[model samples]
Target: MSFVKALIATWHLSILIMFHLSRMRDLKSFYLGYIKRHCQQDFPKQLSYNRFVERQTSVGVYLLLFLNLRCLGPCTGISFIDSTPLRACHIKRAHQHRSLKGWAQTGKSTLGWFYGFKLHLVINDRGEIITFRITHGATDDREPLKSEAFTNKLFGKLVADRGYISQDLFERLFIDDIHMITKRKRNMKNSLMHLHDKVLLRKRALIESVNDQLKNICQIEHTRHRSINNFCSNLLAGLIAYQALEKKPSLDLEHVVSTLKRA
Candidate 1:
């Protein structure tokens, strides 16, 4: 393909893949039913199944990253941070898995131990993704918050779970004008928090809802990945698909505050 033709093909194919994923279609059905049967009318030619997958996988990761960055919504100063497990394979198959051998690792979550990577996300109260990072399952949750690249543009309050509770991390973000709010561990001394902040903490479920939609609706998590490049591509595409969603879970700040005041 010529340079221009390749570029156009990539653009069209990327959109088609994302659209299919949003509708919960696995790649096989997407290629066979949509691209093979229908897409030729729009493209100069139709690629065989293997060739299409090869071309799509060969496309640069930066293209998907750029698309993801573009899909991010504006920062609302109140952000929720969390991570979810992306298991590469079932526990029974972990020993036999070679595709993600060196890259994926065993990690623990609330659900128990699993073998996979961790998807860390920072989203605003509006349920729009602010930024995200993927780390090994064993990596500390608070480690990404220390990166300037991840938190540079982030300001205001960040609410998270107890996993992110660290005095040093708190102070570091504080220095950058980002207030970190997390539930005090039971063993820690009580710290007074404003009612509004407490309410926002309860509303952190918005981010959890986003995670569910990304995995279940956008089809981010699967055990069938064959290559790290395609894995990353699928993940980035899923995130972009979620970003294109018309409606997202959000908190009504005014209503929350009013209800608290009435109490």
Candidate 2:
């Protein structure tokens, strides 16, 4: 009846959350098949798919705030850090891509060259996400760690792969009371490390498991984004949905939780 009518902000967030959590692969199909068919009673005044696309930017800020305030987990002394590539398009199609042309870049990973951005994720031993940073695809894995605000909440021991190993980086974090432990590179000399650190370094795959769940289960990365705002909304919504997962990959830290708490 009225052109000015709009869905409530919470309703908008709920719909975005369902987009990533639902079985449907894309937002159009999910909105048309599921929400339009089964959710009309709950959202009778919802906008059409096209209009919803236009409204994504409105919720982008809200999604980020919700992530920082509600979805994120706390930093346990023992945490893991890792980076994953979020490809905007195949490397071959980089020249033709338009949606994220300037935003994305040509970067190299352990896998190879990809055209997109990088997601640096940090998680605690319990498989809970502590914080994250997104950067240009070419950004070094160690760059985010250089920021004080990024590592402020973290403490005690931080286990990471060799990619994060740098003498200066280690000393900087150590100055802030964050003891970073990583295996020395092939060219580096050996140094004495506690048995606990060695064991946790081997278990660094905990972050990998979280990465798998985020991309495969939570729909964290999709290549079909039509706009940068839409892409951000999708990623944030996926993280919110992930927070609802009952079971997450974790370590047997029951006995050590109290110990770390006191230390």
Candidate 3:
């Protein structure tokens, strides 16, 4: 009986160690080496040691997503935009922490004040993330739309928030031939939305649900870093890790359509 108990304990420990190794093992040797160094020196035992580094190698994940997008044949005709907070630390330590360098800041979220950055994610109708940008808390969601990051994207219907609305942005996107859908501000006079526009506008909430799944189910916003560089590294890593799951792309549009029809 004693031997059997000891064997079971050994098996469980081995399985836990293997799971960590499997997640981190495919990471590039250089990143692995970096994590190994940190684990031996700076990393706290409480941080899950090498597992922390394995989880933050998000660049690797992006490379894969970029490739998967290439495999999708053509760009989908629809896309959605949303922003979420990526807190690096508690708000109480916002100023005291000098570690995140330029990569972190205090951002106002729907959840209230948080100390960290904002991640603007643009995903296509097919539920594939087409582009992403990490900005300081002060960066506006509309600011990135005009940049060259989206310059070549010519023909999709862009659905975003009122925060992204402006005559300049609307005209620019119009010139590029992309249709825009956004709710009007309360104070704006003569604002009217077509029935279809109202229906499409309601779908914007789907992106918010995607953000929730990323943070909650996939654990993207759980930061355990003190340095500025590692914070960025970890942020990117979580996103990439989420992307790696693209081997099984997220829900299909047909499923979403079916659920909506039933509702």
Top candidate when judged by TM-score against the true structure: 1
- Residues 42-118 of candidate 3 have per-residue lDDT tens digits of 32222344654543333334434434454322347677778888887789988776667566777787688888788
Candidate lDDT (C-alpha), each:
0.82, 0.87, 0.61
RMSD of each: 1.8, 3.5, 10.5
- lDDT assessment of candidate 2: 0.87
Off by over 4 Å in 3: 1-74, 244-263
Model 2 TM-score is 0.93
Q: Which stretches of candidate 2 lie over 4 Å from their true place?
A: 1-7, 254-263
True lDDT of residue 43, candidate 3:
29
Residue range 124-228, candidate 2, lDDT tens digits? 988998999999999999999999879988999898888898889999999999999888888888889876676787788899999998899888787999889
Models 1 onward score TM values of: 0.93, 0.93, 0.67
Which ranking of candidates, highest lDDT first? 2, 1, 3
